[model samples]
Target: MTQAPGGGTAGRWAKRDASVVWHGFTQMSSYLDDAPVVVERAEGHELIDVDGNRYLDAISSLWVNTVGHRVPELDEALRRQLDLVAHSTMLGNTNRVVVEFAEALASVVPVDRPHVLFASDGAAAVEQALRIAFQLWANRGVEGRTSYLAFGGAYHGDTVGALSVGAGGFGTEVFDPLRFPVLRAPGFDDPSCLDVAAAMVAEHAHELAAVVVEPLVQGAAGMQMAGPEGFCELAEVCRRHEVLLICDEVATGFGRTGTLFASEQCGLRPDLLCLGKGITGGYLPLSAAVAAGHVFDAFLGPDPSPRTLHHGHSYGGNALAAAVALRHLQLLEERRVLANVGVRSAQLARLLSAGVAPLPGVGDIRVKGLMVGIDLDPPGPAMRWGRRVCAAAVRRGVLLRPLGDVVVLMPPLTVTAGEIERIVAVLGQAIAEVTAS
Candidate 1:
């Protein structure tokens, strides 16, 4: 192999990584051919590979990084909390920083009198929400309210409970046996999907305990979106049917969709809300399943009774993560990050429209705030256009990943005008190069 610019080599680093690492959703057989970037350090929104190449983090570090990498305030918050305490179990006991962080979160989340249950990952948050919704009925003496209603393109999480509600794909079909069936509604791509879902809720209200949705955008479904009016109608139906609503905002939370949460735009106050990803500003692993006061009260009973949720995580409320999350929430308001999202969203939309949408290989282009997916249209099934195009972009110093044929671009919320332009330009170049051949 040829020598790299930096003292270390990417090939050498990848070999070391592949020998010891088992990456999720990745095939280890050809991992070396995929040309993964071995990042040694990060500065702001760019990641410097072991070979000394700097690539703009257009995917927001797998859609978790909110403000940017190495944010000074977030770093300080983590360091400050580290000096105080690192880990304290949240089982039957609480941490000061955790309580404070939850209080601040409850104030802003679109849940009424929210009570939070901390977890370690987005999947865990969604799984807990599923368990809570299932048990909320049993605690209230409601019989046969055991099943859930989910949309066609929904992607909740990979856990058994979460996968049960999610529309299966992404090579998860083998888990079909583990996934308990749910009442299915059409995907958001259909104009009348919400109406159909509302009707299904009304019809199946007897056995249905809850309805889980990815409000505004079905992120893992290639960014399929629906109007806010549709969500408003669905919320009304859920209320009328007395079915609990669970909004999985793991992907759309923390100002990623031009608001603090996507539920705000959709006029929803869910009984259960799942939050993660950017909760700690991409600094630490922390997720939360927030239950509305009404739902939370259902689980209250004797100290050692069945009403209590039997679920708890060991590192659920790490003080260090809580401290960073508290500061990250504050930073969102202090820096006016939502205001920046609105500006950058409009700029990104306009540039993508002018530059990429008109390209021959482009199909549907979806945009919701900084989240975007550009579909690639290939005549035959042999071409992996999405993969090849993203590889081309990565080679051009812009980091992007694809959801199958949809090239996803989730730039950090603090992306600048120049960076947005660069992303669009590189995307266009990559698309042209892949489609022409």
Candidate 2:
């Protein structure tokens, strides 16, 4: 076995991974040199690799983790659920923990009389929301309302339905044949995004089933953000048109946006809400498609009626995941994690402004709560500045990932002040080193 710099075990694991693992969004041919971090464990907000290198989780393990890793209450919740039962079907029956978690989630999510339909991941949740929105019109005896309205630079998920509505990028162009096109609106990158979207809604309201959005920030679009007022205005336009509004808070939910859900900040009580990522505090895979009372009511009818929305996953509402998610939700309030998010967000803004923004090749820095994106100057095809800078930051013990030329930083809500400083300092140095090269 080839020995890595610090350990042979990591090298062996990497070799084994290269042989058997077909990772998504990765080019397997050059995976070793490009992406080499093999995480062994996590503590608080840091990830320990197999080579004993510790890297601060600046992207919250791809924007899922919230409170921190290995939180005691979350751990205990999983253990408690494991003792009772691990796997149960939510098809015909429901479990206690799932019901309790949904109840807890309903209390916080910005949907009137919310009823949750559990799914295993964000894509599945988004897919559920899309189908629910489509079927709601059919169930209400409404015709021609079969289309959807989505913004450019929007990313809901990777599933077919979600991808159909999503603004296509991320090498998803190859699947263009399979994706069903939606009524496209300009994204937040354009100042007139809301104006353009409202116009589209006004023009197509008769045939549009729903207007789907990422609320205030489109994380996958390099944290492209819209004003909360714009979001409220869009919601009003959707309401005025009598069209459903689906808020995909997969990335902005669970206090990531300084609010439990971004919809809360926008004062949007969406007809359907898609939530995931931090729901289980990164402990397990759990997502929910929450429907308003009216939306849920539309699907109800006599037993075995065709009005029922036919969709489900085998692992939907797993007891352990639900239990951990419930505890995570409780801890969010008890520990006042959102308050930390507000303070840390300010610290991050100041640190980035004072430290990284002046560096060469830095174009723009966008931040909403702890979710951040630092857009680098446009690089030539041969110059992967964002990737190189992130790799440098990783070597310096801060793990950062990039979306093309946009360097993203989505640190855990519980990241300490000192840790935030370290992340910023390392990022600045990394940017300098890469730019100088």
Candidate 3:
């Protein structure tokens, strides 16, 4: 393989990165050989590496970026917050920006009379939700409702509490000793998953604190998706059983799945909603665990009361993050971003079915709006077909990543039609080349 023009510069950066930067889910020893792209800046939906090579951000920077990189509105929001204050503890006192953002968030989230508890990332949000749900039962003087019900192939987060309820995969099994067990249900791969989950909820309702799910999509499980009706059925089951329903929308929120929240499409009123990723339009790290009014009321008590659910992050409601997130939320509506998502989603479905799905080695293609996964049938274990295909796409100026044998393509919400075409064309060519090899 040939290197780009600034190979020397990229090589130096890669060496420096390998020496000090221990990236999560990466093997540093082979990082240099992998031809890692060291990004220096971003423009619109493209990432410019140190080598001056521009690659289309096919996965929205791992499904976080929404309105695109370097958005002017998001940048100005952060600047405005900086002029007032940057950091303040949410433990005792709350900042004005935080309060305003929370109000704005509450207006849009699917939960009724939602109360926001800020966190720094998706895992923290899930952890907070888990704790809140567990304590909600205890606060209500409900005994024996101590367990949680989660579906298989669920990827909530990596924190101990989050991982406890999450279905273990992706090299997480080694940490089984640290994770607590939950009542596991089948994933969406099985057509009867919802039926099975409903039955589990009925049988375990007496002991289940909450029925946690990813709503309409299980992103980390190779973009596996469930029908809106299926989610509605599960919600109905939870309601019938008198069990709380927690929607882990960390991946599906902020118009990733053609809706502000997947629960909205499913007609679900989750007791708790976990949001992250695009909350700040990828400008900052911020997440929130939104609780319904009833859930919030359960924790209400006098000062220093044991009924208080005590958990918070040092940078929980950072002013800058809140300000940016509030502006991002506004921009989503003002710019009619969800409308674009609908159009782009249709285009993507057409392109994938016509261009990529029939390519050699392509086994299955799963798509829900912009989130996509292409399952590849490798010739053998040594082929590493998914990684090789993504590498080939990168060489063609398209950035992509794979989940084992599943290649994902999740472009920014603001991506243009031409960019989508380029992504699909490159992916198709890459798959063809790798399979023919």
Scored by lDDT, the top model is 1
lDDT of 2 at 255: 94
| Comparison by lDDT, 1 against 2, better one | 1
- lDDT per model vs. reference: 0.92, 0.91, 0.90
lDDT tens string, model 2, 1-437?
11232345676788888899999998889888765788899888888888777888999999999988889899999999999999799998999999999998888888999999999999999999999999998998999999999999999999999999999999999998999979999989998898889888989999999999998899999999998987777888899999999999999999998999998888999999999999999889999999999999999999989899899999999999999999999999999999999999999999999999988899989999999999999456759898999888887888888999999999999888999999999998889999888
Candidate 1: tens digits of C-alpha lDDT, residues 231-266: 888899899989999999999999989999999999
Task: For model 3, name the residue pairs that clash.
Answer: none
Candidate 3, residues 283-329, lDDT tens digits: the string is 88999999999999999999989799899999998899999999999
Kindly give the stretch of ten consecutive residues in candidate 2 with the minimal lDDT sum. Answer: 1-10
Alpha-carbon TM-score of each model against the true structure = 0.98, 0.98, 0.98
Error of 3 at 18 (Å): 1.2
Query: Residue 413 in candidate 1 has what lDDT?
Result: 92
